[model samples]
Target: MDPQVTLGERERRTWAAFVTMRRDLEGALARDLARDGLSVSDFEVLARLDQAPGGEMRARDLAAAIGWDKARLSKHVTRMVARGLVERREAAEDGRGQVVVLTTGARQVTAAAVPNHVAAVRRHFFDLIEPDELDVLDRVLTRINARAVEG
Candidate 1:
């Protein structure tokens, strides 16, 4: 957008509301995850790892998958290691690389967390939208995501 081209009233309100709603909703979801002894970020990592082939990924790949920088992923993985949720192993195929592996304990944790987190999503988000609104939301988000990747 051109800096001199001012956002119209509708655009301003929509942006403000969207930002506020996203923050508030994220907070609520995080709180819900706290009860499961996981943060949202923790769950994101664990869930992704759980789905990965062999329940592992190169640390760099995991970071990219979650859209986190290496530093953040390293720090978080360290914490998770302390929690016994994951392990960092030297990749045998490439000695210099590190792989993040999901532990049995974390798989259990993810399994336990999934149902509750899904329920919370339904309760806090899905329940608020009408069935028809879902189609519109999915389409809008898909278009926005496609455009986002283009840049």
Candidate 2:
């Protein structure tokens, strides 16, 4: 580990602004998802599955796609299964492994909720930014993500 270094005033302000914006954005999106009877995590998982081929993926793949650990994914899958939104079945190639499949109910709910989520994102974030500004934001985030992944 390297020695701790304090951020300068400008850096501190930038960090604060980044944190605030991320929190606000996530909170607003979560609220919008809630209105459609889905949590943010649920929508994230369902949306990914909805796009996947055959509307199904392995448990590990689903976890990775959604950036969740095994335990968290297991818990959420359990809940979703109980709600009839998804089902876990033995993997066709490897019976020991499990595959997650989106139920018809999940597909229906996700299809309905996507528009609301997109609208909320636009209203709370994108609509406020100019196209040029969005380009800059995309560049900035790509740079940051690359650095984080490298580290």
Over 1-151, each residue of candidate 2 has an lDDT whose tens digit, in order, gives 3335777778899999989999989998998899999999899889999999989999999999888998999999999999999999999996877999999998899889998988998899989999889999999989999998798
Candidate 1 regions off by >4 Å? 1-4
lDDT of each: 0.96, 0.92
* Cα error of candidate 1 at position 65, Å: 0.5
Task: Quote each prediction's TM-score.
Answer: 0.93, 0.94
Q: Model 1: how far is 125 from its true place, Å?
A: 1.1
lDDT by residue (99-140, candidate 1, tens digit) is: 999999999999999999999999999999999999999999
Minimum summed lDDT over a 10-residue window in model 1 is located at 1-10
